[model samples]
Target: MSMRLARPGTSDKAETSPLAVRGLTVSYGGDPVVFSVDMTVAPGQMTAIVGPNGAGKSTLLKACLGIVKPLAGRITAWGKPVARQSSRIAYVPQRTSIDWDFPVTVIDVVLMGMYRDLGLLRRVRPQHREAAMACLDRVGMRDFADRQIGQLSGGQQQRVFLARALAQQADLFLLDEPFAGVDAATESAIIAVLKALRDEGRTIVAVHHDLSTVEAYFDRVFLINRRRIAEGPVSTAFTTDTLHEAYGGRLSDGFTARRA
Candidate 1:
């Protein structure tokens, strides 16, 4: 894929750090979920956060996106605090989080990403529509632009959400389980888009659960279980030791342990 130009105001001299998290900790219902964690996402890199079920991987992503407030520590994007630069980040939640019964067409859902830039009183201009369509095309979902979101298959729905994130045109992209329940074809398509984004100097971080795909799909991997166990290039960080520490006997035991 051809590299896209960097967003305006991002200086050429600026170090290409897309996200920085320091001492991040989160709690749910007053119970600690994600412990103090430090992580950084560099431009043009695909970073995957992996762990066992209830390992706080999803919570970590949410904390970075500011959807779930962190009890302690800081998160910055493009050198600015996340709370101050929310527009610079786009997030695609787990597919199950969306209400499939909601009355909305594919186009409508994709257009939601543009609401921040368009504001409440303003209408979606032709430029906005064109951009949204282009995003859908990039994800190979242009043909489904008018279809009802609920009627589409799981993979199609994922593509639509990804297209919506593309339409947001943010500097950083956070995705939760983009591969879950997706068919091989859809998974390939999604990975291609992610690779394109990384090649274009965008930072893409995903909460990924499939250990088997880590080495194949990501440039960097973070193994976490409440706290970080290891983080670095997949080859260096995704070791048996780290897996054992992060997932305990579960990862080594088999699917049952991993799922437990």
Candidate 2:
């Protein structure tokens, strides 16, 4: 099933805000994993969430998308609570979670993105097909749309998932570890597509590793380690002091090149 793209609104009105979080907290089996946190994601920005492993970067993304319930505080998307605005939010989880044995085609998986708008019973229309193809083209995966997802390389699979997110036509995107385990070229392609989306007035938040690429890739950075140690433009937030705070007193692995 597929959904038709909503018509673009008038340019006069300001673009809608993307996401807001207040006093947010998360826990695993009653153990608090993230402390109270506040954040707002503006339209047309690419923000990277970074920290050491188990720093709650993925937890934050999951909390914002309503996949993991917050122990305290509220999350709002486009001024509505996450539960009420699921359709406007798109999520791309880690590729490791995908079942490689599944016999679905790349296009089929990408088409699933529209299922939320199409509901359950409807078939994908020509418009949906066209939109899906366009999204694939944007990610440079149009030629592989018919191939089985399992047959693709790690980078190709990543692009396929990105195409799926594009098909959703969402205003806010939350991508977890999209660059992990992919080749440098695939990483570059994903970053380019994300920048294009940001340029087109969409909001994107990603859980990213590779401290070397943080400044080169993201406009804003949120350093997290169960709490928000710092958040602001990359130039301000990627400092040694903030890195130490976010990485539990160790500044070696988290500092940007300028600080090293």
Candidate 3:
């Protein structure tokens, strides 16, 4: 599903976009990873952040979630600071960023998503467990709720993380490589669930690796290479020129030929 998006540089009414980043600049050590970037994620659309390796795609997502402090720029969700809207946002980090060896049960990891609502003092009520189970069921992982998180296969682990995100019942989802290590079936299932969320009017933004599937899975694409290269609907912004600009010399001749 797609919504009519405002043209880049055009004015949008307050609180209209689920996410808006302006003049974003992030640095680690002395080098900047993301520089002077601007992005606006349309509500109810699945948006992809695409670029070559080491292009700061993950950093951009982290900056949006306030996981990394930006050297410059503003990030807001519905016109409010991201820090103030933490509960309304659900984040799924890269599987590689997680400690799969951590000793946590599948259900326990999912229950953690409810901490914002459950608070530090409240007990884990039965209704909360039921809701968590429903989220697991949605991701086809209810049967593995009692299993150790470290024991699951990569795809299963990704599904469990998605379940954790779903448990938030959030309005804007920021996922980092949700399909990186998953099998084809798992990828299909995850995309289906994400599309379902978009159908429900939730906004989804992800750091995506598969260029071939960008047009298929996302309504809008933001091409980046340590900076804002291009961003808009897939049909308009995801062109051969933009891909070349973002991926640089990394893309194969055959790939460019195919895109051409």
lDDT of each: 0.84, 0.83, 0.90
Model 3 C-alpha lDDT per residue in residues 1-260, reported as the tens digit of each score: 02222336543632578899988999997799998888989899999999999999999999999899999999889999899999999999999988888988999999999999889899999999999999999999999999998999899999999999999999999999999989998999999999999999999999999988998999999988987888889998898888888877898878879988
Better of 1 and 3 by TM-score: 3
Encode model 1's per-residue lDDT on 1-260: one tens digit a residue.
Answer: 02211222233223346787778899987678988787767577899999989989999999887888889987777677788888888899999998987889998888999989888889888988889999999989999988888899999999999999998888789999999999999999999999989898888999997887887889999778888788778887777667777877776566435534
Instruction: State candidate 2's TM-score.
Output: 0.89
User: Each candidate: how many clashes?
Assistant: 0, 0, 0
For candidate 1, give the lDDT of residue 202: 87
lDDT of 2 by residue, 1-260 (tens): 02211222332222245777777899998667888876666567889999889888889999888888888987777777788888888899999988977999998988999998678889889888888899999988999988999899999999999999998888888999999999888999999999998898888899998888898999988778877777778887777767767765554653434676
Candidate RMSDs in order: 7.4, 8.2, 3.7
Q: Distance from true position, residue 125, model 1, in Å?
A: 2.3
In order of appearance, the predictions have TM-scores of 0.89, 0.89, 0.95
Query: What local lDDT score does residue 250 receive in model 2, on the 0 to 100 scale?
Result: 56
The per-residue C-alpha lDDT of model 1 at residue 146 equals 87
Which candidate tops lDDT?
3
Candidate 1 off by > 4 Å: 1-16, 253-260
Error of 1 at 45 (Å): 0.5
